[model samples]
Target: MECAAVSAPVSSHPPPSQINTSPEGKKPPEHLRRIIGEPPGPIVALLTRGVWALLTALSPAARDALARFVGNLAYTLGIRRKVALDNLAQAMPEKSEAERRAIARGAYITMARVVVESLPAGDRMTPDWDKQGIEGEEAWAALKAHVATGKGVLLATAHFGNWELVGQMLIRFGVPLNALVRPLKGALNTRIAENRLGAGAGLIYPKGAIQEITDAVNRGESAFMLLDQALPAKAAVFVPFFGRLASTTPAMAVAAERTGAPVFVVMGVRPPGPGARFRLEVEGPIPAPKPGEFADPITEHTARVTAALERAIRRHPEQWLWLHRRWKVQPPAALVTAPSPGLTSGPAPESAPKV
Candidate 1:
């Protein structure tokens, strides 16, 4: 179904899916707001805020260099450094170890920039998002047009580039967008979550949100969904990413198929320069499958969308977070290997333990 024709949005928030929204800043009367688990909440909060402040204090150019330097250093020493390198090797098999290492190093810096831009202070510093960043004008225009057409845009993006900045950029330009915010326990996590909301984005708790997301789209509002993470077998549909069967969520695909909502990809891509500035592009309205071509239309569509994400990441290998254990879940026996002629199919091998 095409989403290029609606004229109005149906709701400001999410689904009648009756989701539980986060309580970030408001101090309720109960001690329920205090640190739920361990890890010394006070220290973690202080360090996070302090780093945010320090990054803010530096000039844009200086901080940009520092972010990259720190990222590289962290990658060199990080427990997950090998993970990142391994991911890169698998994702870009043609690349040599040195090349993969370079990509991994750049990924750490990209992550640093992600962390910095996500900080509350970063929002304060970036008052002129339009002036500093370029491109994405057409993409944003497409999003506005799609949502205006009445089929609310089903936003699809990966954890590449400055993913968060895409929302911030839209908020800067007065476009309303909502995305799922993972619920983290503890008062500090709440505050950080609140800060994100305060910076001009809306949140939708993940549980029970199908109809809620549909309702939001029906209203001509846009909801952002990150589809590049590793999903559990229960929630996952194995899809080819970098030529491997990585478990991916089919929620967006199913939503589009079920509701006829238009799907769009909104990803943040930063150009090469001294400072971290993004070209937050929102592109798509991926056409629905014609049906009967694949065994499952949902898996086909999900894989198609994921392929688009892979293409985007390929363009800027350094910007994607390679440190993540994106391939932790192995393909099931049926998909991993076919039975040899006159022989039985073998079970899939186990993956290496995560670091």
Candidate 2:
């Protein structure tokens, strides 16, 4: 079934403000040599395409079974097992060791599934919303309302679930999206760009995407990016994530403040069972900073969105990408001692409502 139709008169574009750019470092010199052990891009692309072809030929159930097998193999062999387990321990210390291990195992399986699902395998895997889809009514309504205003939205998402599918789903629902992604090596990057375009979404690379993103939003188009990755201390704001202070990018908050766009957190979840359909969850127009609301509105806005993401992850802990070192960057003693107003230093109570 389709979402309830939302209608609003398109409004005039707001005057552009100085864009806030991401704190990405300069590119390395072209003369720099490729690191040893890295394969050529074309070879990697060919192998990737071969794997995709094999996976695509299987029925959805069979593909899921294969993914589970791979995930279990990886976990049993201790491939990045320590990293995932450590992240889980830090994030969910309340859980018993056995419980955390189970979550990690599930995470590995989900990660494998995500890799296969994200591949560019033509239309075989495109979601048929009418037959196999569930939407969060309140969150969907909020997204439609924001889009109705004709001011493009800033979508803050994470690596949780099948994030690539979320964009495709939105396109099906008539929302145009441009996602900011870090370029991969060689032909792999080109393949991904083609896949995103093939799925009806636009691409914005991070090196110089600020101006392009700003223009797109002002023209009433949404921009999407992952807000769950770690950033260097200088380019990040300390925010509470999983009961610890983690470095988070403030790009979405800055863009929203400058362009008068609302921010929303969207994710896609795969339910239990073989060949399960995806459930799309949206949360926000996360409260923006009012005039003189705090000493550092950017920090406050970043924290609010981060908290929303944490809640989403808690709901389906197994679906999140726990393999990465999410809390690698720490704040200095001075900033930790003098935390920003309205930003909590303690972990969230266990009873917080799930998204």
Candidate 3:
């Protein structure tokens, strides 16, 4: 059982505490530390732009190959390797460490492939859902029902699975969608926008996407939001995920509360087969908040979505993204869940023990 190398545990040897310990300046609690944080800054934006430009300039074959190469290299170097394995260990508490590490490696490789596969135009993209094991009958039915009523629909998704195909699949299957996205920093952002829109789906920028979402619902257009990432302190809710508390955004729940539109959770799965074929699966209106509760739908919807994502990750432990710092910060008091027995109060476990 081989595991990639990662930084020492935050528990065994505390890295410099990100929180301020000064008495005059109130120190943020453990939970609050994980919840609030910002995305990459201007310098990060610049690097992303450079990468995006380089990737876009490559030929399709070259791009795909590069994706595969990156995945392989990540596994060898063990960069964020522990993060991926630790996440898997939590997601699948019953699995052996060896099995969990295998899954994490596979997931990294698959994500790399997905990044490139999403590069081609809708028509040019290969590995159709039908061939890849995508059984979207239920989602299609739900889409038709909402479209017929002319009330609009919200499709909530996460970083899990091959989500890139949602828009393409929707278009090919007769459900055109408008997706909401966090605009990327530089050139990468520009290319992602172009490539994504090239598939015939409408996209709204996240900074001021609220109005667009409202308008889309009013106009009866479907919308998609990747809601699995951690949220800012004021906007997050700590939810039980894989027996651990994780800060989650409540946007999906809030959207449903406001629009009266149905919610459909969708994921792109990598089918069990040869080279790297994938599938798309759609599940549930998953029961949104009842008639009365409307104050914080983001927290509510986020919990439901996180629960669903946990289930999916457990099913395909190796396909989820583990490289990214999904749990970099902790949530505040209002957002924290009841503490688990073994989890210490100071900081999250840097390296989880295998079952």
Per-model TM-score, in order, reads 0.77, 0.83, 0.72
Error of 1 at 277 (Å): 1.8
Query: How well does candidate 2 score on lDDT at residue 101?
Result: 95
lDDT tens digits by residue: candidate 1, 27-93: 2222212222233378777876676577667777776776777797898787599899878878899
Predicted candidate 3 versus true structure: per-residue lDDT over 122-236, tens digit per residue: 2334433345544455554655677657556878776765666655555444454567665454433454455555555566655555666677777656677776676675676
Better of 1 and 3 by TM-score: 1
* Residue pairs clashing, model 2: none
Steric overlap count per candidate? 9, 0, 12
For TM-score, the strongest prediction is: 2
Ranking by TM-score: 2, 1, 3
Which of the predicted structures, 1 or 2, would earn the higher lDDT when compared with the native?
A: 2
